[model samples]
Target: MSLLQTAPTCDPDDQWCVWVSELTGNDWLAQAADWLIAKPLALLVLLIIAFVARWLLHRMIDRVTNRAAEGLPTPMLKHKPGKDVPATVLSGRRVQRAQTMGSLLKSIASIVVFTITGITALAQLGFAVGPLIASAGIVGIALGFGAQSLVTDFLSGIFMIVEDQYGVGDAVDLGEAVGTVEAVGLRVTRLRDVEGTVWYVRNGEIIRVGNQSQNWARTVVDVPVSHEQDLFRVQSVLKDVAHEVWEDEDFRSVILEEPEVWGVQDMTPDWITVRVTLKTAPLEQWGVAREMRERIKARFDHLGIELARPARVLIHRDNRAAGEDLETTGAPDGSGTPASS
Candidate 1:
């Protein structure tokens, strides 16, 4: 008779071992003692269940969030008078938040699934998890207190999500630093600057943020010229240039309203500052400004106008006593020699 037949009694001490021995009609208890071998089918089934649960939960969350967000009008895409401009529609802020929400939901679902799977597996192995959970709770509380910054980061991240201040792909000015939001998590936000440098800033530490791509960006161009240049001629030249630039296919597509020259904004003894404003598409202001600069330089060069800057034309002089005077002794017309002291 196998061990299972002999150990038919329900003894929790060696229930699985005895059952396996009885079914196999062999001393598998020795192998079980040496190594706790888990059945592949059971492990595979558990993992599959966990994976499916995670997938289903994630899909549900994404579907719900997307539907809800889509139902509500997104401010980032809508213009609000002076607060927003026609260029706001092109900003990626709203869409980026949707994607970020999806990612966060997916992460949460994965964690929930894994935690359930771990607990289920532990239960199946006949391990008592009550004390483990209690101990874990205590440890977590202690850790939370010790690592208050971590808690602050987590809380701040939650608030950030709720407020929707900025999201991935949105251009933001984090204090003095400016960058596009690449990723936002429970702890840190990743930003890619214009120079391609990535900054990882903790959410808790970010006290204030300036989101440039929130709705629309305003660009101001200042062109300074020497006071010698004619003011009316400069304004007329700028007007003609603006018209030409506006007519251009490139600027027309990016510019919403006609470019306006604000006339002579300021005048000083050395230079005059001319201001021009253009209503451009979001993020297109840079290109428009650059094109305007090129046009200004070309027009100025053609008009024989020079850019103003500080300059000096120095004339050196030297005075000496009667005994060491250049007027007393000279070597040549170009060179002067002082009299002997």
Candidate 2:
């Protein structure tokens, strides 16, 4: 009976309105029912899409993570002198790093997927998506400003792990904290110093990193001998001692290369320093240097090599002769006042 069959409150192609309008007619009731039914259906679809997308993204992430983990390099720990490179397996540090990366990616993907779904649901329910998004952006900005340091720390840690700048068992000098890394995390790096004091350092605060445990290390021992001793002779003796240390069965395992005497490193009136150096395994420099010094000392004792010693000369007047008492007013105290000797 009515030429205007389309509901004014609903879209022309809205299927929900058309389906329910067959019984209720194209009236307010149809539109009301369409809203009640259509909005929920749209929200349901969005949720399904969100879940599917999240699943796909997570699966992709897992695949990529596994690949990365399997192909991970072993730069953080050097290859042993006489051993081949170990295979990358889901164990030890490589697995730990892969797990960290995968978890972070999954979390980000979930947040993004769910957030988009929520916004779409709100828009479907007749809420202004623009203002909602703008308000969310403002709130996000506020939160970012408030938690800048936390964000920086997290980002820094991620990069540190990815780039293999440092890791557990690495002796690192991270600005104020210089020690062996005990644990690495997203926000803080734990270290234990030579004194065994544990340090929790925020990753964001580290500027430059000095990793002393990666690759190989060098041991330098400066042996000072009397300047009067022949420099060439001391250098030969130091070279011999260094070679003995490097060849010793106990020290040879830590020493990577043959030792060398680097001639004189410094010269003073009292002594000349002979620099002996050895290439050693990571973290083995200290022990190797100590051993080199001990061997050099024992060798010097056997060879009667004179070590440098501080010297000072003091002169006194030898006045025990009869003519020495002929002085009239020589001050024995050395004061300006005249006095009898």
Candidate 3:
């Protein structure tokens, strides 16, 4: 008889037939078919959910950034008498900070979500995830011990972002590197120097930072003139130059205050250095200084104010064939020569 028809070998009163029939029933095939189709669908659904979550997270971050940016006070809206922070700079910093925070959040969320998804997918594939998790923990500990510097870098970067130490587009001097910040990340900072060279600096390595574009800057101009020039005249000319620059419509907004002419910073044999100081908006000092120099040169040239020049003096010695007495006297050219007593 066929195997299917020979099932009466077991007693009808016994439970063995019932158990064997159940084991061989269509129910197991249905369950197998369902699992064969459902597991992959479940994994796919999970991945889709992860993608959606990431998108939503980024959307939320963008919303927060826009709201925060809107709340920032414009320079014209709130004019605090000595506060030099520009509205544009503040807005830029806010956006940069928000982006940095968003990147960090997204990175962390992706790690967690992907890790969970992977574990779940593995479990669906009939793998023991508990042992895997334990092994991952051990590996993580070993990596942590081996990559202490990396940990320190991430920690430092977090604090740096939180404290707003520096941001992209800011000119910073980070002890070892001086350049404009191009990007700030959890482990590294990218910079572009004046020479167009790019640098990647570890966040942990930056102990101190000098931000040149913050708030305000001072433009210092040292003009050297012939020592014999009238000091008061030079001072008056410098003051005039400062006043002109301050009142100019193009530069009026950049200059914060009237220029101060600090007279006679130093006196050398050939030149007297007069110091001119001006308080200007951040990043404006260089342009202002250059313009001031050009204007001052024109003014000096127009007024015939002589600048310092190198001077040379010569000494003449005379020798007679016989033992003759020699007398010397100072000449107008600062030279000494034999002369009649």
Candidate 4:
């Protein structure tokens, strides 16, 4: 009875339907044949729709990825006029990010496209879909609890990408690790420190991020002078030194603006600290600071500037009245007596 159940509507005049009914001498057998033929046609339609949707989504992803790779203008970051993008300045990190994002999006599209098609096709084939979806939801919840950390990592990585928190080649401080990011993934981020030690930090474990290579950096130099030196004179000399560096052809490219001399950063009995600061392109701070130090040393030496030095005190003690005996090992007679202070 179940096998002979009624099929969906079919014309009595259909040649195949009629042929099947006559050959088998049963109406139900002909209806079953018609149902079988229709199922394949429906499945073929679903397959075509799925493939088209996937292809369209993949193309969109590729377009966006290519734009990002070329440094497309964003609200936060705009490309400057007349500056070519990434000829020599093009780095591997940007390309990698684009590729990774593209691949992830494509994979997700494929999964969604195939999943929907499969569920719909199953329903068309007369299988009950409600129970299967319900069971899938329960299984999903169980997996969510069992693999909470993995899900957290995946969600965190997605947010980071969407928010543009940090990327490869960026110097960041990620709580337990501080270094240059070498690779970024949905689960872990790889970093290489100054000592060339690589660190793998979990994306879920990152609480806060300190990105040092975002836009610009500042170079700070503190010049310590003898406390007795004239504050005005020291500041003037420092300003001259800073301006001199800024004017240099080699430094002009990196320096963003005029250097500022912040007078009297700190004052102690021994020395007065004069702080100078310069704004430079990202990651250029160290090189500019080194240049500033070298130039300051040379200029200070040329002008005979007095630098602060540690003070030394000498004490004289007479031990004749003390109960302790004084000994002088250097008694010209090769004696073992200890020397006097």
* Top-lDDT structure, candidate number: 4
What TM-score does structure 4 among the candidates reach? Answer: 0.72
For candidate 4, give the lDDT of residue 198: 100
lDDT of 2 at 301: 92
Sort the candidates on lDDT, descending order: 4, 3, 2, 1
Compose the digit string of candidate 2's lDDT tens values, residues 231-282.
8888888888888887889986778778888898987766777898988777
Top candidate (TM-score): 4
List of clashing residue pairs for candidate 3: none
Each prediction's total of clashing residue pairs, residues at least 3 apart in sequence or on different chains, is 0, 0, 0, 3
- Model 2 residue 160 CA deviation (Å) reads 3.9
Clashing pairs in 1: none
Stretches off by above 4 angstroms in model 4 are: 1-45, 64-104, 124-126, 313-341
Per-prediction TM-score: 0.66, 0.64, 0.71, 0.72
After superposition, which runs of candidate 1 have C-alpha atoms over 4 Å from their true positions?
1-52, 64-88, 120-127, 161-164, 167-171, 176-185, 192-198, 226-233, 303-316, 319-341
| Candidate 3 vs candidate 4, TM-score winner | 4
**TM-score of candidate 2 on Cα atoms, chains taken together:** 0.64
Candidate lDDT values, in order: 0.71, 0.76, 0.77, 0.79
Q: How far is candidate 1 from the true structure (C-alpha RMSD, Å)?
A: 9.0
Q: What's model 2's lDDT at 150?
A: 94
